[model samples]
Target: MSLTPSSSTAPAAADPLTPLLTELESALGSVQAALSQRDALALERHAASVQRLMTDALREGRERGRGGDLTPALRQRLAAAGAQVAAQRAALGRATAALDRAIDVLMPPEPLGLYGQSGRTLRQRSSGDVASA
Candidate 1:
């Protein structure tokens, strides 16, 4: 009947945020596994899920600011999860760069113009020029 949150209601309010945090951690793990396997498709899917979870978590946290404080254990777990995600992201970047280099090596750029035996650009001949048979 009161506008203020009772102790009992506080826990219930914080409950939603907990699952978001858990989902984020799980998504990070999936991302790491995908990266290890070099599965780009799976990595992209997991990354998108992680992003969604993060946005939801941030919004929930802000809304619950008036509810209560997060437990120290949860805070620590969140920090560890975030660090793991960052490390995996750096690894992904390196892997992508290596892949790009490999592709470049396999498919080199084409030359622009035709060259002569003397290494000079060949000029087009006019129809009026006669051939020395």
Candidate 2:
């Protein structure tokens, strides 16, 4: 037989994860956008969509008997997304801490009194009264 491509061989099927990965990428980008815009409702909605997409992707992978066996490029993209989320979270945390510090400085807490209450009595007493003693 001549060394040539066989007509009987069919083309490889497209990867099932491609669409899921694409959707996930879009959702992650939306989440980042919402974060940057400080849009709580949009952020929450996109975050939930991201979570659902991850679950669906996991289910698809497991169904295909390829649990956690993602291609290198896909894994790299996931890692980058995770790093981006982590960086955003860290920045938010730092901002919150700074705000807390600023608020504390602006409105200091009241100091505790010696008797654990304000330095005042409800009733005054005369010196010779037994209640005064």
Which number leads on lDDT? 1
Question: Estimated TM-score per prediction?
Answer: 0.65, 0.57
lDDT of each: 0.71, 0.65
Can you write out model 1's per-residue Cα lDDT over 28-50, one digit (the tens) per residue?
Answer: 88998888898889999999998
1-133 in candidate 2: lDDT tens per residue? Answer: 3333442232213566667868887998898898789888998899899888877766665565465446677666656656766776787688678866775576444455643343223112221234653
Error of 1 at 6 (Å): 11
